[model samples]
Target: MPIKGSSKGIVGRVGSLRGLSTALMLGVALLLVGPVAAEDFPLRDKYASVGVPPVETGELAGSLDAMTVVDARSPYEYETLHIRDAVSIPLASRDFNESVRTLAEESGQPLVFYCNGVTCAVSYKAALKAKKVGVKDARVYDAGVFTWAQTHPEHTVLLGEPLQSTDQLIADEAFKDRLLDEDGFYARIQSSTDPVIVDIRSQDQRQGVSLFQMKDRHVPLTNDNRELGGLVQAAMNEQRPMFFVDATGKQVRWLQYYLDEQGVEEYWFLEGGASKIYEGMGLQ
Candidate 1:
């Protein structure tokens, strides 16, 4: 959620504007998603603006079975939770286009791709790539897994079981508790008890240099909770507060579930991930 009137999700920060390209993409996508008023947000900046219309219930009403709903997120995210009958084709994979072609050719159905929400660009980017690779029947579901699983729990699965409650997602307050701006983050680093700073960006997203040269641990973020559990265990064993950074802050939202599940209470997420250090992410 961006501050009441601004496109950026955080409060009181100035940086280079991401508005130009974002606005242009949304202008093109709105024609597909349906008519929108100035007030209809998330569409505006609640998530990444895409050059394609995102799928919603109206688009799939009676044809959900006819269309292939592809999860363009990581395997770990898919394993954690996903729409029923959806197939995973991570956009990050090297064979992403070939995989999409194989599935599209095999199924011969319209492909509806989705990811972490409008907040993330994986789904839309996947659709664009599929189209570029000549898969014309591709589409995007930018609303993301969190929204679908919450509103349609019966059609969702969590940890290999049918999802039971909307509670599976982290609450806003819980997320807020772990969120820290650059200033607050740096301030805490000066504490007598040194905190553990972990970088959870994937290999591709790592810009090839450390943000915290003195003590930054590289721990790539994955949906496979086990790796994260290992970090949590280490933090607990050493009695250290953990600080995690991702490409964008959105990933930590899902990772929070693993942290809570493992009983790791003291942790913080970079407000907009490390990208915020260079430029505000998510619709700045």
Candidate 2:
């Protein structure tokens, strides 16, 4: 079924497939001249995984002993309920920087960042700020408090914090894996009102690419299709929706995790990399 948004011409549809099939989900809205045909669509029955490098649940359990786990949720959210020992440093607060700096100086341990949930980007923003302040290790717990609630129900959760378990999120029939389809990617782009589409390719690679003849503003993530931090930041600034088109699913997935940490709610990547988008345009 197609989900409608505020845009002029865009539609998102998740197919009728069922039961834990690892199909990458791509939600795209397109305005094409003719009855557009999607060829070589990347989305299939293959699951696409997301989020931060696995923090050993054991490591996470042990982390509470010697490390400071900072919750980047707002004060109201914090006061309602929170995990045991999780300090509040709302990303929206004026004192966020100061609080983080003070913690870094006093504690002398790497800071672990978390936000409300997987879709929330607060922890990623917190981690970026922590890195700037010279905190040696600023790891983002991408799952955030929601996932934490699922995995560690024994831990105290802040009152009013919405709870959606890991099983619920992962098994969520609606959870769309971004690595799946060409049309799905377009649906994601259509969802955003004014998305900053980032082409995370090298200068040379970008020069060699084109997206549906609908030229989008692109920022090179590397000189030779390498590091992706620049593109990551560009996507993070988007207030509406954002899209990152890369050379491979691997890099795009990483970018999604980074964006997730920043608390970006709506975001996506072009499936089959940049070339696939072009190929659909009949451009090789």
Candidate 3:
């Protein structure tokens, strides 16, 4: 039940660009296909059928007291910055339908969905989906959290510490910049001073020779693992940095983002995952 796009499998497949910088290439790719403008919000013709209307930022601001504002972005995005009192129900969640239904049934106010910006479609899609499930009053505040922060900084909220802008939040949530190559990871584990490695691979995946001689703790990543939070909390309470590893470095991204949302900031992931470690140590 990890959110879509959470796994390493979904990481952008950058074709060979040996001469070009990876970061620069990523930036250009994002620029080419990034969020659309407010004017270009998708499914414009279908809004009427969905019975969801677009709520302008100003209107949403005025009506916050009267509406149930739901952030429809990923947990990472929601934790980074959101409307002061909005609750998050990410569009990517497997329980999204149930969450929306429960919120609709419990709250007397209309549901308002918002994400990063007008270009982001999560809010719109969430609103539509909610309406499809009988939440007739779902609304999309397409202006998004970033726009709200820019216009009404005092009315924003963040997960852990205060940040000045949405850009900072994006930077903080970036995983690629924090990835540890095999050598770096090996060095860290050998030192055993700072980060405590947490292997999230499944039991089957751990059947053979373990990386770092299996010195790390095993905590399988699953959507409904109730104990996962407790395990992470214990690590945080001990004030130890966590470094996560999975089969292919994909699962750790989801785990990392989830940890970030929970206010656990001191963490990193092994680049290319356990496979990389196996290859590096000639275990492969």
For every candidate in turn, the CA RMSD to the true structure comes to: 11.7, 17.7, 11.9
Where does model 1 exceed 4 Å of error? 1-53, 223-227, 280-284
What lDDT tens digits, residue by residue, belong to model 2 across residues 116-185? Answer: 5444566777777777766766766654554455556566442323333323222222234545588877
> How do the predictions measure up, each by TM-score?
0.76, 0.38, 0.48
Task: Flag regions of model 3 displaced more than 4 Å.
Answer: 1-49, 92-95, 160-284
On TM-score, the candidate that comes out on top is 1
Best by lDDT: 1
* Poorest 10 consecutive residues by lDDT, candidate 1: 18-27
- Candidate 2: C-alpha lDDT: 0.51
For candidate 1, what is the TM-score?
Answer: 0.76
